[model samples]
Target: MKKLAIFLFASLLGATAQAAEYVIDTKGAHAFIQFRIKHLGYSWLYGRFDDFNGSFQYDESKPEASSINVNIDVNSLDSNHAERDKHLRGEDFLFVEKYPTATFKSTSYEPAGDGKGKLTGDLTLRGVTKPITIDVTHVGGGKDPWGGFRQGFTGSTEFKLKDFGIDYDLGPASQTVEMILDVEGIRK
Candidate 1:
């Protein structure tokens, strides 16, 4: 009877499990937000935001219920060229003076097994909000050297340049931009 009672208790506990909450480890430089766009149909221009932070909730048992939120500093864009970076920050592109921040809030997650899924979220940029879907892959998760648990994920999404109302005319080949996000979160 005691054995049966213990089994029933364990079953109840398992049924009540909840997702683990985590803060993106930006302070540790384990999180990054990057982008790539065609440069005049000749080559690709890659850049990354130096300042961004976020958090997420994930549970291996219920992956579909995971969620995440992130905020980015628009002025933190770096493209390795000072002149181009300046132009990108002006009225032609980001216009950081007017819109200094961007954000993403997850709406849903669809698991596809093998640590892959599609994450749909509302992305706000340049004062406009639109739904974007990211293809996400769970990197791995385990205990850190400091004895804290961590989870990591990599995701990518692409959207048309004009979708956010920044129609600076980058030509037909540069009509889209792709973003890559690598997030490692410490369990909280």
Candidate 2:
């Protein structure tokens, strides 16, 4: 009888320790957003956004309650080529002068097994907002040597630029672009 009481007490303590509120530290975190599109029906041209900021609250047990917010400067588009980068920010593409930033807000989450899930959110680009779903995987979360709680995550999503009014064409350049995001957040 004493052993059973001890076991229950230990289980309660373990559950309490597992529940923690993690604050995402933006400075300690890194986010990379990359996209690839078919260029001229021959090859794919990959590009990425260089400047962006985001934050998220995550709980492994209650992932559905997690929320994410992100902001990306449209002018930060980098295609590696100078001319292409400028053109991408021009009126023909993102039109950075009018809409300087794109944003995303997560609204729902669904489990996909093995620490992975589907996050559905509203993505706003070029003044248009649409619901997009991203595939997300939890890389793991733990404490750093310096005492910071860090969490790692990866996500991927895709959409067509034309759907958001980016109708510029580069001789068969695919309108659809596949996007991938690698993100790490630290407890605030």
Candidate 3:
């Protein structure tokens, strides 16, 4: 009986020490979601989504168990030009009226050397869901001055607009869009 009790307590301790989950600090400007696409095959047009929220689970001891999920507000797209932004929010592009949000949920994590990894997940945009892989680099992680633990990462991926049903053509220039994500999360 004594040995069994000890074993159960040790197992509980090990489970508690395995992984920690963190909530993305969206309200504190800890995340940035931006995209860029070629314009007329000449210049790159850049834009960002103003509002988004996400959360992640990090297991330093078992990095393979880490995962992330994010939700972006589609109507908050900004391009620094009101006209262009409005058009992007219209039916020809994002169709924010119908699909007000985009989402990504990590399905797998493959670690590379030096705090880098390949994150493959399902990205849903414009009511279409597809698998996309992003290369992610862990920036750093530690306890913040505010008495909270934090972690950050930057990732990027490129995909064709037509894959997500955004078929608007701009003279063969807007076929592909490159998305970059910088995210920071606080331990919950």
CA lDDT of each prediction against the hidden true structure: 0.94, 0.84, 0.92
Score residue 41 of candidate 2 by CA lDDT.
Answer: 80
Predicted candidate 2 versus true structure: per-residue lDDT over 84-181, tens digit per residue: 89988889988999999999999988888898999999999999999999999999888899888888888898898888998777665587889988
Q: Over 4 Å off in model 3, which ranges? A: 1-17
Q: Give candidate 1 regions above 4 Å deviation.
A: 1-17
Error of 3 at 110 (Å): 0.2
Rank ordering of all candidates by TM-score, starting from the highest: 3, 1, 2
Model 3 — which ten-residue stretch has the worst lDDT? 166-175
Per-residue CA lDDT of model 1 for 1-188, tens digit only, reads 99999999998677545788899999999999999999899999999999988899999988998999999998999999999999998888898999999999999999999999999999999889999999999999999999999999999999997999889978899999999999999999
| Winning model by lDDT | 1
lDDT of 1 at 5: 100
Worst 10 residues of 1 by lDDT: 11-20
For each candidate in turn, the TM-score is 0.90, 0.84, 0.91
In candidate 3, the residue pairs with backbone N, CA or C atoms under 3 Å apart (3 or more residues apart, or in different chains) clash, namely none
| Comparing 2 and 3 on TM-score, the stronger one | 3
The RMSD of every model to the true structure, in order and in angstroms, is: 4.8, 6.5, 3.1
Candidate 3 global TM-score: 0.91
